[model samples]
Target: MSQTSFQTPTNKIVLSISQLNQQSRNLLEGALSRIWVEGEISNFVRPSSGHMYLTLKDDQSQIRAAMFRGQNQGLSFTPKNGQLVQVRGKVSLYAPRGDYQLIIDHMEEAGEGALRREFEQLKQRLSEQGLFDPAHKKDLPDIPKHIGVITSPTGAAVRDILSVLKRRFPAAKVTLIPVAVQGDKAKTEIVHALDRADNFNQGQELPIELIILGRGGGSLEDLWAFNEEIVAQAIYRCKIPIVSAVGHEIDFTIADFVADLRAPTPSAAAELVSPDQQELQQRIQDFEQFFVSTIQTQLVQQQQKLTWLQKRLKHPGQRLRDHQQRLDELDSRLHNAIQNALQLKKTQLRASHTNLLRVTPTHRITQLKNQQNNLKHRLLLALQNSNQHAQQHISQLAQRMHAISPLATLARGYAIVSDPDKNIIRTSEQLQVGQLIETQLHQGHVVSEVKRIKKK
Candidate 1:
């Protein structure tokens, strides 16, 4: 029981650097919750995965941040460096680098973002007012002859529009009204230009047909003049149809919605207003060819009718003679038909008379009379032969009877004897002594007594 000692157990807790980092990440993420941050953006990089990597910084501090594609895609405008932004996100540790970072869920521009919000609000308000309704919009002219343009006259937009108009329909004329396309003064210039076009079209013989309102592409601030409420109202009130072709196809302003139609570019608006001359030429040629073909067909049909009429012309006497000949031929055929029919009927009647004579009742009666005479003769001869045969047979029977008669035997001298009882005796043995007997001859009889009987 003497020496007991305590020693440390062999088991020990162990971890690699990666395992330590992962545990730290779990702890840090659990401790820090989601929060809002405001800072100017720097070192902003967008990768092929659509995820944005950036650093949010202030004068003294900075923090690494990430905004995934799904979150960044909701932003209306692209984010850039040095842009002040507000972000809402959760704190997270990027385990590979063992670095702490924030994962953003939402982002919005710090200052100019308010203007974008105001643009959407005004658009919604006017839409509810029905200013942008399709029923309220005027229809563009099918082929406008006199077009009016309201834009910066020296801009590229005017050059492209003029080129398209000349190429498509050189018959059309475009009147350009030069104006400032931006700044606070730009919206006023556009309004006055639209009113002036309206006033000019009222009493003119060849009125302005369509109006094109446009400018080149720019940032939202650069294009803000067209977004003014007064400009939208001016387009709405103009009697002449307006086609708003402002900026690139992707860029939109308030004027685009208020106009009668919106073209993606100024050149496209020109094409819409001008009709193709080549199409009209082809249609005219088709009509000419159709007219010529119809007339020719009618002439040929009339010529054929004239030829038929000439063939049908005839002399009255020749027609009458032809009719008389046909009538004579019909009469001859009718007479021949009647003769042939009468001949057939006579032949049928003679054959019928011969058949009637063969089956007459008088001839049948004569043959019956001959048969009756022949049968009568045969019956008389048969009766005579039968009577003769019956008489001879009766005579022969009488002779036979006469030969077998008892009197015939008596006549031959043979006598018959019997006891007095008249019983005949043919043997002596039949007689008894002292019996009286009688004898008969042909004409007499005798009585005697039996004296004795002899044995023999």
Candidate 2:
């Protein structure tokens, strides 16, 4: 080797602290791009920013690990200290501390048994509180007037629900209550939205009568907000009925247990409350067809009845013949009655004429002549008999009169005594002593005073 003096000129370049730190980070990240690590977690901390910081350790070594909020957001289970976990991420250096750490993108419980135990514990707690009781469930509205939705405003779930509602029942009103569908604030926002929908009629004329609380399909952690106790209680307490649609057709949550109904998806929930408009229109058309056919049938029956009645109506010739026959019968009966009456009148007149002739004036005159002759003969005999009878009767009557005469009694020496003023004599018993009396004899009367009493 020959000693030759060759001097090389140095060009110095200086970097800022950030540029130096970035270079170091790139170098360490490239060195451990893909790695699988198993260890127990320690000194675990979750900051308000949603990033996790922890130490991973084995019996002989320990290293730091971190889970950024974005990557860990979809984890089904939470990470805790002293828990064994398996992490899949890249190894990187923190330039500020120059310390090596694992940047975890995925993590799971180290054993399947541990994950199952955690799931059972959560399920047991919820079940013991009667969250899954059918008695606490409500019934779905048969006809929904307004449908309220609680979901992410920009999510596919909202689009699916709107599409189904529009096709099935376009007249129904939809109220969207936009909320976070995942993350820590999801449960709180969902509960508040449910309350608002339930009380929407407070200041309005109409309100949502049925609510759909749902989210699109995701893992258990992404859909955990609906499984929260607060969300389940809100569903139970809602005055308006609720339909729970979380995750997929096979996934269920606490909200599903307490809601009025459970649908397989957001679209299915819409269909539950609404009917197809086209189907209803088809039914109405069928009814109209049936009604028209019935009317035609009745009209046909009425026309047939009218035709039969027309055939039975009487003809003019038959009506005239019937009237003529009746008139002929009446004339014949009238002629016979007139003839009988004439014979009866003639017989009665003959009997009257014979009765008058039997007692005619000529016969009566002959009888009167006979009666006059007999009367003349009887008159002479009657005069002779009357003269003889008169003499005998006069003698008998005079003799009888002489027997009852008062003069005859007087001649027999009988006298009558009476009051002188009245000349009335009844009996001697009526006379009183010293009373004036009059004596009536056959020749004259004498008046004197009673001088003695005589009882005989």
Top candidate on TM-score is 1
Query: Tens digit of lDDT per residue, candidate 1, span 332-444?
Result: 99999999999999999999999888689997889889999999999999999999999999999999999999999999999999887778899988988989999998998
Number of clashes in model 1?
A: 0
Name the TM-score of candidate 1.
0.46
Question: Which TM-score value belongs to model 2?
Answer: 0.42
Q: Write the per-residue lDDT of candidate 2 for residues 91-164, one digit (tens) a residue.
A: 88887777878999999888643545555666678779876778877776666777788999999999999999
The C-alpha lDDT values of all candidates are 0.89, 0.85
Q: TM-score for each prediction?
A: 0.46, 0.42
**Which pairs in model 1 have colliding backbones?**
none
What's the residue-level lDDT of 447 in candidate 1? 87
* Positional deviation of residue 60's Cα in model 1 after best superposition, in angstroms: 7.3
